[model samples]
Target chain A: MTNSQNNSSVVDPRGPKPRKIMSRRNIILYGTLLVVAIYYLIPLYVMIVTSLKGMPEIRLGNIFSPPVEVTFEPWIKAWAQACTGLNCDGLSRGFWNSVKITIPSVFVSIAIASINGYALANWRFKGANLFFTILIFGAFIPYQIMIYPLVILLRDLGIYTKLPGLILIHSIFGMPILTLLFRNYFTTIPEELFKAARVDGAKFWGIYFRVMMPMSLPIFVVAIIMQVTGIWNDFLFGVIYTKPDTYPMTVQLNNIVNSVQGVKEYNVNMAATLLTGLVPLTVYFVSGKLFVKGITAGAVKG
Target chain B: MNSIEINNLSLNFGDVKVLKDLNLSVNKGEFLVLLGASGCGKSTLLNCIAGLLEINDGQIYINNQNVTWFEPSERGIGMVFQSYALYPQMSVKGNLSFSLKNAKLSKDEIEKRVKHASEILQIESLLDRKPAALSGGQRQRVAIGRALVRDVEVFLFDEPLSNLDAKLRTELRVEIKRLHQKLDNTMIYVTHDQIEAMTLADRIAIMRDGLIQQLDTPKIIYSNPVNKYVAGFIGSPGMNFLKGKILQDGKPIFKLEGGWCESPDLSNYKFQETIKVEKEVWLGIRPESVVVGGEAENMPVNFNLEIEVFEPMGADTLVWSQIGGQEFRFMVDVNTSINVGGTLTVGFDPAHASIFDLESEERL
Candidate 1:
């Protein structure tokens, strides 16, 4: 009995002599993660150092150099006004436009995606598999292929080159990926929960609106990051579909940096680039918490 | 008070039929377990009851209200998923209150219910933390809390305890049992693990190849299994089978290949009336029923054997040896001083053994 008790104590978590040892593989795993961390930090280091330098200082171009003149002017110039066109309004105008596009696009597209993904994953119907087939197939099609048709369609609506138009375009193009991400996420969720909801008198829309949508916030963040990045940095559709007045930050940034006559504004360009990346970057950072939470909560139980 | 009833239910995924005319009724407030091996359509059957999967042809009624065409949420059930499926963005309180929020209940009422649920699940301290902050068992409790907060009549658990470690599984199993006892709600649980079914369900339904092979109380499943499949599936180490023959003298005798004699009483059975045995039979014996080494003449059904292999478990030691033309295993006292190739008389108890028609594989 004493031996049994000793064995139980050793096997049990609270007692001494933890049986689980970090294997040799774990050391290699940590070493690999450390290497990856160094790789990921390299570009950010360059960006920060580059952002600190003036045009003349930038020309010297030692990637590791600490700027002799640590000035915030580039960041400021990118924010307030750098000449995108004759209208000296800087990256901020496009930044606001990106916000306008990303907000509606992310929410609308993600909402639709979660609903569609849930249906495809959990619900059954005759054409459901076909719908999934079409959607997955739609995801592989190049983004450029749909541009002409989409631009024409928006132009016919007369809301073309407007904020809503850009938002709509972003949503339409983003549907496949957003739906796909949510679908894969929801697939890992056991079917019993849906059935329990069904037996609880949860209708299709009821479960989707209440249980599934609420349970899908991680995929939502993932969708936000994807859509924000894709739509925020978009130039082709933004240029063709929107007027000069409504151009997003990417288009404006391009016009400023790409133009030969416009005096090259390196500091402003870098600042604008950082600003353009900021919303999606911020979204990724903020939503990353939820993403981590979702896996623990919704995907893995043990 | 919701009782789910399925009639003539069959579901096919593409060309493969996963469920075939499954007919079963789970009474109100009863805990029903669908136990089977993986790919046996137990989960599929549970989904059909939950109204998550559409039956190819059948009717599903919840509390006598036909809900074959109803949506999942409208089916009046609360389910716990194996993955937990807790809303990550929501706090434990938020996750618990979400369904109530969707039900458009007043905020105060939602809070009251969420509070009660958290208390019931013993997760009140972790209500404010996101799922990321909680341990696996805690997350599982929150999942149960989420299900409990929604006042559904039928509870569905799709292998909810599968993700838990063995110790945590035992802990949560007791908690689930307590919850069931308190709520007295109809619950349909699906698991590939028979032990879970045996410990939890009021009645365990065994499924094989999309059909329910046997449905009975745990005791009956353990002792009075209808076929070899049920007999093998329900018990740890399972029941053993040996080739035997029914004699003309109304005696069922098990023939041994390596010079062994075993017998189990078949005088009360009607196997001969159903199918002619023609001297071919299968004798089934559970390990615990058989004893090892004693006076050979005193034993009713005794066989001489050489212990070929032995496995020691603290309480009991398993003695495995070749008997008849097949391998046979028997459990004995752990202190049994037996070694490989040692000669000893193995005793078989006649009363606890079962006889089956060899060709049909059906218990007689």
Candidate 2:
């Protein structure tokens, strides 16, 4: 080729042209994302708006509109005065019951499951795989099918309709999945670290507490979020295992929203629904970053 | 007295044997390296000594006490891993002191050990920094520091320098050698890198297929490998092997397979056993042992070969050539001018060469 022609044909390396804001790819991608976001946000918006409105405003029945006059009376009533079953003391008692159930259940299940995971991941005594297989199999079993058996079991143990009974039930049901999560997460940590711990004169419990536990903050955050949300939002186990006196907030919420004794106060129902969800929501917000990291770390390996 | 002894150690993973009938003994204050290719069970042997792996059949002794059934911690050993294996969440100080605290040492003792270890490792300034914040070399130094604080009589290193870059690996290899000298403790280091084994080891156990092919000082292993496998595994450019047969008249003479050149005189060669008759053998000549140009004139066995390629490796140039249609290599000065397709005279004394029997592949 001629020198001038060769030089002219050689194009300088340049980046792709920037696409316009309204390109088809951008439109489709952001459109689907916006629709999905709005789909979830609309219900949350309606609940928030409905909870802020007074009874007369809620009666006007424009659910999407902002309240003409904001009132927190429904919230106060949901917390104190509103009746749940025979008690007119509102969800305060049930909230405390949930606190009692959730805190211990989360801690106990995590403590046991984390140790189970560490053993399964690092130390392979005989039958460890069999034990892990059974634990994982437990995770896949339908919770509904076990309710009757669990009720009988708890009743025989003389903890039926008690806070401790519900706590025990939550702890047991939370074990299999939490253990699986912890096992997968612990497996992602380099095996050499475990070996090094063993060589450094750290025995089983020492290694677990000092090495594995310290390095596993993200996974622990993940477990806490899972157990807190699962135990707090549970309606079936709480209702089945506890009586009205010790009913968790979720069960009490069902009583308030589904009661047939009086006028259905929409604002009070929304306020109580929001209050019931507040604990888990706060947990997710607080540990959202680590939640994503822990999930990806566990999923990518083991 | 021996610091660590392993007897009849055999470990199996189901049907696959990872280590088979392995026996090793390390002298007190000696630095022994287990050198091998990957999957050769070098690291597995180190783990067995550390009590990290339970042997299927064997006994391990540390400082004259049988520790076969002891817990890893109870075995009184410290280990560094290839991945450095530092506690990512803890500061360098915490990493050093965690096990000391776990052992229930007094706070003053723990602090004293940590300070001593960090100072010796030249990581005193990094004491408060977490592993994630440190560089690779710094992190590895901290890992070594962790082992140092244990004050164990035996230290196990499972390829601790394998993860570092080439420059860092050389730097850390020297540091490890220096550390061994300063601490005067028995160390068992496992690595696939031959150079590290050669430089850092007082003696190297060259392993293959879960068995140690040779165990001797680095100089002895280099100059007089017990078998062909070790002779081939130890050197960087690798020793050149010529397929030949040894015929005995009055003295042994190695006949080239293709009769490409005159048979090399082997009268001066040392034999492990007396040669009975004509036998198939491999004549191994290390690249550095093969003198080229004018120096080839005085050698016991000398020949001219056509050079096919040359590689300049900065310090020395490796010249690739052929002998009896087999590939052969020799090292020459980097400044030596070389051209492919040119004839070059190369020679090696059989005394410096290793001859292995063709059937058993054992050194003669």
Q: Which candidate is the best by lDDT?
A: 2
Q: Tell me the DockQ of each model, to 2 decimals.
A: 0.31, 0.72
Off by over 4 Å in 2: A1-24, B248-251, B276-278
TM-score of 1: 0.74
Q: Which stretches of candidate 1 lie over 4 Å from their true place?
A: A1-126, A136-151, A160-167, A188-222, A242-302, B1-4, B27-31, B72-76, B88-155, B167-189, B195-202, B247-277, B293-297, B349-351
lDDT of 1: 0.79
lDDT of 1 by residue, B83-186 (tens): 88776666878777767766788988988898888888888899899988988899888878877888878888889989989999998988899999999999
Candidate 2 to truth, TM? 0.93
lDDT of 1 by residue, A122-169 (tens): 876669888988998999999889888887888899788898988888
Would you list the clashing residue pairs of candidate 2?
none
lDDT for position B343 in model 2: 84
Instruction: State the lDDT at A152 in candidate 2.
Output: 94
Error of 2 at B192 (Å): 1.5
- Report, in order, each candidate's fnat: 0.55, 0.88
